[model samples]
Target: QLMSVVAVGDQLVQQQHFGAERIQERLQDTLGNWNHLLDLAALRRKRLEEAVDFHQFFADADDVDIWMLDTLRLVSSEDVGRDEANVQSLLKKHKDATEELKNYASTIEALHTQAGQLGEQDRTAPEVVERLNSIDHRYQELLELAKLRKQRLLDALSLYKLFSEADGVEQWIGEKDRMLQTMVPAKDIEDVEIMKHRYDGFDKEMNANASRVAVVNQLARQLLHVEHPNCEQIVARQNQLNHEWAELREKAEGKREELNSAHGVQSFHIECRETISWIEDKKRILQSTDSLEMDLTGIMTLQRRLSGMERDLAAIQAKLDSLEAEADAIEAEHPEEAAVIRERITQITQIWEQLTQMLKERDSKLEEAGDLHRFLRDLDHFQAWLTKTQTDVASEDIPGSLADAERLLNQHQAIREEIDNYTDDYTKMMEYGENITAEPSTQQDPQYMFLRERLKALRDGWQELHQMWENRQQLLSQSLNLQMYNRDTRQAEVLLSQQEHVLSKDDAVMNLEQAENLIKRHEAFLTTMEANDDKINSVVQFAGRLCDEGHFAADKVSKKAENIADRRNANRERALQQMEKLKDQLLLHQFLQDCEELGEWVQEKKFIAQDETYRSAKTVHSKWTRHQAFEAEIASNKDRLVRVQQAGEELMKEKPELAELIAPKIKELQQQFQ
Candidate 1:
């Protein structure tokens, strides 16, 4: 109604009616006063309701607080069970208690809500607020205690469950371990196969139980993840389970490998036996027919049979290789029996090798027998060639010249080449004779004795022929050396005579330049003379060597060497005298030239020192430094001057004739020095 009146007044005022403003103001003032009175009356009613609510709140709060105290005592109880069953039973009761606490949650919330309402109504009422806070505090404590109690129960249950599960797994592992430990190893193939089949099933069963063990591990991990009170025990149980599980697996795998190796070894042994029997049979066949027949047909039959046997042996080799591989694997799998197994393998291998050897020897003997007639034909041919070669090698013709001797040596070498061409035939025949004589059946044959005698005669003839060829070759080589020596001696003597004639020439030098040229010419002449001397010495040495080697012309070579040595000594002495004369003239010329050079150097230094450029202050120090360097240079040339003077004096003494030549240079140099 007041809203409608206010709406009507607002419309009249907006329309500017005559009394609308006055009436609106008066109505607003009256409503204000009425609202103030209603506020007072509401405050009075709220106080009355708050008094009643405060008492009721206290009552509900006290009730909840009392129940919480009892619940706290129950939650704080240390009655965690010692076993799975006990813990499980306690867990169930704790669960029921938890449910009851949850049921009371709403009632407690309601009372809390009431307290809030009462406090909201009268904020100055500390007692009501305090009581409400105390109830809330107790409620929170009860909740935490209950939660902790439930966790403890759960921890205990989980611990017990883990223990139970771990015990079961351990029991299972132990049972399996004992079974594996106590199992009898297979002794044969059949037994191994049966055992392997059973172990496979057992392994699968063990693998299937792995999930059960995993469950136990998962339970333990959960307890650990949550940090259960029995964390130490949980970890210990987990480690033990893991250790035992690993060990059990190891044992199972070991047993499996053991059985497998047993089967492989047993199979290997059986195959080895079969291979051995086969090898023995083949060996007997080889031995029975090992005898060689004198006829081609019989020998061919034996060869074909041996070839067939070899093919069979080759086929059996694959089986042996397989058996060996199997044996290796078994040995790798089981080391304790490796030696025995390998010994057996080695014995069988030895037998196989022996059979192979027998086959090889038989084949060789057959081949040798087949080659007998060819051997005899080659022997006869070789013997005839040896006899003819002996006649050629033993020829008594002596070479008289280098060409003849060289021709003879070349002919001997050709004979040697021919002998070399038949060397393989000779070796083959000798081997044939030895083979025939060495055979047990043929040892007493007259043909064998003849072959032996023929071989001995051939060897002796070959040795004699070789020695004859060597002797003839040595004679021819020595004849060639003698001819070379004679030719070299003649040539050396001619060269020495030419060089000696050159050295005896009367060459004269006019001036220093002419003397230098003459000295160079003399040096050249001496070089030529030295070469001639070397040649003559070589001739003499060659003659001496020929004498040492007992050459047929040693006496002639010695006389030629004496003549050549005399000529060589005379030429050398004359050449030395010529060189000394030329050198003395050259020295005189060099001394005169040195004296002239020293005089010029002295004059040059005197000119440089006589300069007067040191008068200026600015140029004084530099000029003095240059002047001092010039003086030091002149001082250094004093040695050159003294050396030149001494050389001039020495030349004047050595050759009094050169004193007239170098006296002016020495005097002028002395003047320059003074």
Candidate 2:
């Protein structure tokens, strides 16, 4: 529009209108000056905005540069720490500085952005790029220096941790070593056993300490590998710990050996004293002087006593031999006590020999007295004949057939008749013995009392023979009659024997499958036994009925029936017990299996719960989200854990024996869960 106006004005000027040329020239000049002033003002505003941007960049960069210098000084400090507490304090300060530096990351980023904008407006602004670069370089240096300082402080803290741990273990070692020095040598077997048991507990603790020390050493090695500042101190602490531990072990081992030796020596002394006391008792008995009897009975009694003493002496001799063997072992291990042990053994052997000699002399005196008595010769012959007759009576077995049983009965009758004939002879001998004892000279003699005793024994033996013959005759007759009635009794006996063998088996159940199989097998066997119940009952009833009918073998039949009934009842009870035991075992096995499965699931959850690798998330939000998910999983699974605990408690309430096995597992799981 202005150009159109200028063109119209020029045309008017050319037409020579009044003042057209002057107005056109003045409009051109005025338009030119207005355009120049507008351009100048626009130029001035652009320059002012650029100046603001540059000064803003400078202000931000200078602030960051000042921070870098201060942080550099802080990071560059050579002081690691004076001690653990000091190191921790310095570490905390370094951590705060590191966080402050991290906060500056955004400020530095904003500076880069502003510098980029400035560079884009004018590529020649090298100052902005150079200042930004300088600030970036200083920030990176601060980061590295801060990192180095933090690491140094951490290394110092780790070194102190080693010192603390090693000091604690060394203190424990010192206490234990003092305790070991106070442990006196045991005076007896029981004392030694107690001491050794306590020592074993210490040994276990020492083993655990060894592991702790190993961990300390391993940390020391790690620090050394990193070229820790206190290398010499770490080496010194490591060597001191290892050396103290070695010394403690040496002292413990020496005490163990000493206790063992003392135990062996004390055991030998106690056994030796007991043996000597026993020998003295035997000697007193041997040396006793009761009035001697010249009668045959007294001589025989003396001989029997001598024979028993000889047997006792033989047993004592065996004990001495064992003691000698033990002493040999003790001497081999502990030679210093060999003399005392040998002397005690020698004393025991001498006393034992003296007792043997005493026994021999007593035996010889009894033998000589026996030779002087004429009545002893006859009494010996009679006793020999009596023993033979008793053997014949006692040797009869149950007859297999009726004829054989009847024959045995007839033979028993003849033996009874012979015993009756001997009864008269026994009476005459007793009269003769009484008459000899009635003589005044014989009455005054110690042998007279022995004569009366001999007579009484002969009469008792004669009576015992009569009673034994009568019993044998009765048994033979019963056998003859029992042959016909033994079929039912024999069948029950055979069945009981078979069932006894079956019930005797005691196989152990090892697993759920085995327990179940055993229970099934037992149930089947019980079923079979149940089916045989009627057969067993019928046999008992039949025998009982025969007894009620006054059968010839009624007594024997009744006894046999009662025995069969008792055995059948016993076997039934046993079968029921076996089935119950198997079922219980199966229950136990199933419970253990369920517990094992639950334990494995709990263990899996524990492994996941104990994980500390959430730092894998690069951002705080990612880490927080992952942790929240983890917490949710734990909360969801809590009910499952509670169910496991409830199940364990219920199982313990139901089966008390399982409490011994499962309580510890439950408690451990509960602790880990907490």
Candidate 3:
């Protein structure tokens, strides 16, 4: 029983350890937190520029606030710093604490490792309290100093981005300007002058743009404080370092005040221990931070984003150049249209205002680019939008309307040439070949045939169309009426004096054939009033129906009725009195000899109203009557239209080559009011 009691006592002696081991564990834990401490500092530094009021934020970062909450980690249960109790009586009582703890832990670990070994019970624990107490002075000081240095190092690491190569941006800007100048021509005096002005503008713009990037970088840096090197030399030898510091601190604390060193030896011992402890601490820290150290994911993303941003900027610049070149080419081709182009240029000048505002918005968005990849993606989008906006204005375009106009002009010019040729031939005959002959030529000249063709065409237009109502429905009747009833027919004019015939012949060149060709061309040249004429009558009828149903005037009626009713109705009574002048027109018309009175007061007493210059009621009445007759004829013209259409088709085929050209002008005249 005594032997068993001794064995149990021996076991108790071998297994015992005190607070010294716990202190080392606590220190290791403190070092572990340091990894996150440095990371949080970095985050703060990165975000500070955009978060100038970060301190004002009431919600603290969850895991990230650890560094700023430093007091939570380093303070002990005694409401003092970890190393604050160096001079306490209980602390001093543990004189052998440091060495004993190390020896005890080693033995215990060996025991557990060799649990089945023979005679393991013979092993004894060291005097833990005395050894730990002995090393307390050195290890405590070392741990405290390491903590302070680590804090400072973390501060420096937080601000690494601020010390970028972009600090030399001004130098880069200067070089860029020099490159821009070199790219421009300097040989021509005006070019040199323009380049000089451009250089000045570039200088200012670069300064402004550069300053923006710099200010942001500077703001980011402002929140970072310099770091102290809390790191110790890392290696497997660090265990020895911790052991040595523990011994030194234990020895020195026995001989001096807790806060200050005595002899230089004490201070040296304190420092050595600290350096050694830091090395051990660093080894542990390296273990915890290895994952973070190996990871370059965030930084690499930032770099990639920045690269993308640069590419986007380059693309935008290329697109802008393309737009500018197209605009310049368009301007160069139409020098006579310079006024219109200048107006477009003025419109483009307003684009600068819009671009400036857009750039201001872009500047704001740039700050949101947290990493290089995000920045690049955003830049691409911005560039595409910019390109689209610029392309909308400066892109090359075909002026279809102008092309149509030019084609019409060419047709007119060709007709003018033909007319000029005909006139030239006439002038030649008049000037050189012959006197004005009273008889037809005996010679069968081809030129005369051509002249006769032109005269016949002219006669067709004047006689068939303008000679009285010669509707083709009654061709014989029309011909008789034109020949006999209408005194002004071209055929009748053929019976006039020889001079009259010559004059009429001259007027007969633009015949129905030419008019038909002109009409066809004009129809093609003019813009269609509607997509097709099929809906024209329907649209008009629908609009008229709406107007009639509503008792409301249409735009056409409103505009015309306002003019007539407002101008004429207000003067109705005065206008009736003004009709006394019309009697004068009747009086001046000695046309009807001895005209009766207009209202039959007395035929001879009326004295013919004596004013031929006055506005004539007969003219107005004749116009109204002619319009009514034409309307009536139009109302009864179904068969006449069919006959005229057949005749038109027949004549059109006779000159099919020029038929397309003449159809438009003929259609124009034919489609007009009588």
Best by lDDT: 1
Backbone atom clashes (below 3 Å) for every candidate = 0, 0, 48
Candidate 1 per-residue lDDT, tens place, 1-674, comes to: 87687778788888988997797797788789779889999998988888787787777777887888887778889999989999988888888887888788898778767766774645347777677677777777777888999888888888888999999989988888888876676677887888888898888989899998999989988888888888998999899999999989988888887787677788788878888889889878778775646443345456557656766977888877877887787788779989989987998899889878888877776667657645554665687788888888888888777788788889988998887887787777787778767878766666566667778999898788878888888888888898899789879978987876787678776668988888788788777776666677788899999999999778988998998898888878887888788888789778867877787778877775575653343666787887688778878988998899899888889889878878888888888888
RMSD of each: 20.4, 32.3, 46.1
Evaluate candidate 1 by giving its C-alpha RMSD to the native, one decimal. 20.4
Give stretches of model 3 more than 4 Å off: 1-151, 154-160, 180-674
> Which candidate has the top score in TM-score?
2
What digit string (tens of lDDT, one per residue) describes model 3 on residues 339-368?
A: 654554444445434543544544344444
Error of 1 at 621 (Å): 79
lDDT score, candidate 1, position 271: 79
**Candidate 2 segments exceeding 4 Å error:** 1-20, 77-100, 119-123, 150-154, 186-198, 217-236, 288-315, 322-343, 366-674
lDDT per residue as tens, model 2, 1-674: 87777777778888888998687787789789879989999989987888888788898788888878888899999998877888989988899999999998998998788776763554247777678778888889888988888888898899999998898999999999998987787666888878878888988998888998898899999999989988999999999999998999999999888887787788789889999898898888767624556454466566545545666777788899899999998889878878988999999989888887877777667667643343454555566678788888886587888778877888887887777776665666667677777777776566677667767887787777777887787677666657745765677778888888989999988899999888888888888888877778887777776666566678778888888889999999998888877877776677667656666776786676567664566899998887899788778767766776787687779878778876886777667667
The TM-score-based order of candidates, best leading, equals 2, 1, 3
Worst 10 residues of 2 by lDDT: 370-379
TM-score of each: 0.38, 0.49, 0.17
